[model samples]
Each structure stands twice: as C-alpha cells, then as structure tokens.
Target chain A: MARVAIQHEDFDLSNEIAELRRHDKRVGAVCSFVGTVRGREEGTHGPPVLSMELEHYPGMTEKAIEAMIDEALHRFDIFGVRIIHRVGLLAPGDQIVLVAVTSAHRGQSYQACEFLMDYLKTQAPFWKKERTPQGEQWVDARVSDDAAAARWGIPGGNG
Target chain B: MKIAVRYFASIREAIGQGGETVETRAETLAALRDELIARGEPHAGALARGKSVRMAIDQVMSDEAAALREGAEVAFFPPVTGG
Candidate 1:
C-alpha cells in the first residue's frame, strides 16, 4: 500500500499499525495519533455540530502529504510511516485522520509521529466545513496550529 | 503562457467554480492574480488584496514573488485547517 492515503473510508487503527510493523523484527516502537470529529466544543454554547464535510485539492492533497512523509523520514530515524485522511461527509465521533510511525526506539517513534501531525495541520490542503443547527460554515485556521508547526522550524502555518 | 488555477473551500464557494485554465502574459502569480481581479465581480472580491488567500505554484507552497512558468498549476485558498 502507498504510504499516504486520502480516502473517504474510516480506517482501522490497529490494522494500520500492525501493517506498519509487519514482518519487521527490528521494529520496537510504534507511535500513532488519530483525530476524530468533535460534536461539541468544551465550554462553548454554540449549536452542536451534526456533520462535517471535508474538501481537498485532489491530486495535490495526496502529493503534499507524501512529501511530508518524505521529510519526516529524512529528519528522523523512522522505519515506516502511514498517514490516512478521510474526506466526504462524516458524522460526529467519526475518525477523520490518522498518523502512524514506526521506529527502532520510542524516542524516534514519538518525535516522528508528533512532527508529522504538526506538519499536516499547517501544510495539508484539506479544508473542513462543519454543519450545525445554525448553518454550515468552513472551519477557520487557528494561529496556534501555525505556532505548533513553526516550533518544528517549518513556518507558514497556511493560516 | 497558459496556467491552471484552482480554488478550494470558501474561496471556491465565492468564485462559484473549482478551477479554470487561463491565458495571460502575467509573469508571476501576483501579476496573474491582479489580472484576474481586473475581471471584476467575485474574482476581484474573493482574491482581493489583504484577503487571506494562500498560494502554491506547481503544487508547492510558495510566495507570490515566485515566478510562474508555462503550464504551471496554481492554487488559491484560505489557510488550511486540516489535521
């Protein structure tokens, strides 16, 4: 399978992690992050989100993510990497994204996983639109996310 | 020269289209954007100066000062919110 996938299907996290470490005797650490759609935000009185629509720049989305994985490989001692981002209509509590990395040690695995996620947050070409009782609106980019990526020395949070 | 331009999310909604091919003499993304803005209406407003439109040339994130080449693919949209 390709290292990066932009799909509409919900992924099985365990299966993905297993696949990453399959047949690799030297692999000792696997770190992963899965992001899900939140129906409601904490301490906010806004209408609860009913669904989310994800839009992406097709060919560019996949290519951008693949490049990110390449960068991660170069910066870390990771052995395997898999990133999957789901698109289309999704209900609350649905999984939207997954970033999994495999390495020989916990340090490399952990760092690579976080690095990939921070990079994806600011650099990927995907846009999210939330649907609520009030109406549907495109999600705004957060400055904090930009800062998160910049902490890794990759500026331009795209926000 | 010819180039392809794409829009996403809110910008796509505002412009009422996803992408288009344009023929122009503009040498860079900034010049091309100015030319499109001259077309009036949504193009002028959605891609107006001071807007939060981010751009990429040939699928790589870049600044407006980056020179354009023939058949290059360009994109314009708001900041990305994806994780």
Candidate 2:
C-alpha cells in the first residue's frame, strides 16, 4: 500500500488503520486525525458554503508528502504511516483528509500524528477553493497554522 | 538557463495559464521572478512583490535565495490552504 494517497475517492478509516497494524506484532498504539469540510469556516454567521473544490500539483504533491512521512519516521519511533487526502469537488460535512500512525508506544504515535498534520497544513502543495452563495473564493492560509509547524522546529511559514 | 515554470491556485487563474518554458539569465529564484514580472501584464499583477507567493524547485519547498538550474522545474503559488 502507498504511504501517501491523493485522490478523489473517499477513504475508509477502519480499513486503513487496520492495515497499518495488521502484520506488525510490535504495534501497540494507533493515532489518527480526520479533517472535514464545514458550512462556514470563519464564523457561524459567515456565508454558508455550497461546496469545496480542491486543486493540487500532481507530481509535487505526492513527492512532498512522501518526504514528510520519511521525516516523521526518522523523528518518531513509529511502525507505519498512512495519509489520504481527497481532491476535486466535495460538499459540506464530507471527509477531506486522514492521517494515521502506529507505534510501539502511545506518545510517539500521538506526537508524530500532530507533526505530520502541521507539516501538511503549510508545506503540502494543495489549494482549496470554496463555493458559497456569493461565489467561489479561494481559502486563505492562516498565521496560526504557520505557528503550529514552527512549534515542531520545522520552517514552513508560507503565509 | 532554461526552466519550466508552473503556477497554481489563484496565481494560475490570474496568469491565465498553467505553465511555460522560460529562457532567462536569472541566477536565482528571486531574479527569475523579477524577470517574469518585468514582462508586464498578467505576470506583474499576479506575482508582484509582497504578494505572499510561495515557491518550489524540483518539487521541494524553496525560498527566493535558491539558485536556478538548467532544466529545473519551478512552481509559484499562493500559500497553501489544504488540511
């Protein structure tokens, strides 16, 4: 199985997690994160979102994610990692991303999961454009996300 | 040197094209950007200075200081927003 996947199809969390720890006897912990599209991003009173269209640099997207997974493995004592990100058109409440890690202990997997997510937020070459009643608008990168990656001693401030 | 340049997201839309091959005397990424901006029109407006543009070379995140190489693949885009 590929450690990183960028596709238009939805992923099954249970199946992915199970596959991560399947043949590994040393696996003692599993940690995962899921991201979803919401009706409003800024505030509850913000314009209701109709859908989200995602764009990615095909060759670079896969290469960048694979490199980060290698970084995660080097930094943490993790047994496996699986990341899936959906692209194309998606509606509110639809699943958007998944990051899962397995390790011999809970702490490593937990930390690695967050680290990978932070890295993905800023470093990955994916763009999100939202459709609302007003029209389509590209989502802007947040400063907070930059700070999140910096906390891990990673330099990924693209904002 | 000649390089393949790619643009994404809003930058791609603003530039009105996805990519192009440029023949330039630029020694660095910053210089290459300036050369493009000097072309005027769509490039100057879309990739103007202080536009919060991000760059990559050979599929790796890079800064303006990165040196240019022949046959390199360079990309420009706004800051990423995907989760």
Candidate with maximal DockQ: 2
- Stretches of model 1 off by over 4 angstroms after superposition: none
DockQ of each: 0.80, 0.88
lDDT of 1 by residue, B1-83 (tens): 99999888999999999999999999988999999999998999999998888888988888888899999999998899887
What is the Cα-based TM-score of model 1?
Answer: 0.97
Every candidate's CA RMSD: 1.0, 0.8
Candidate 1 residue-wise lDDT, A1-159, digit = tens: 689988999999999999989999889999999999999855688789999999988888888899999999999999999999999999999999999999999999899999999999888999999999989999988888888889889886465
TM-score of each: 0.97, 0.98
lDDT per residue for candidate 2 within A1-159, as digits (tens), equals 889999999999999999888989999999999999998977788999999999999999999999999999999999899999999999999999999999999999999999999999999999999999999999989899999999999886676
**Residue pairs whose backbone atoms clash in candidate 1:** none
Task: Write one digit per residue (lDDT tens) for candidate 2, span B1-83.
Answer: 88999999999999999999999999999999999999998999999997999999998999999999999999999999888
Tell the DockQ for candidate 1: 0.80
Candidate 2 Cα RMSD (Å) = 0.8
Model 1 alpha-carbon miss at residue B57, Å: 1.6
What is the lDDT of every predicted structure here?
0.91, 0.95
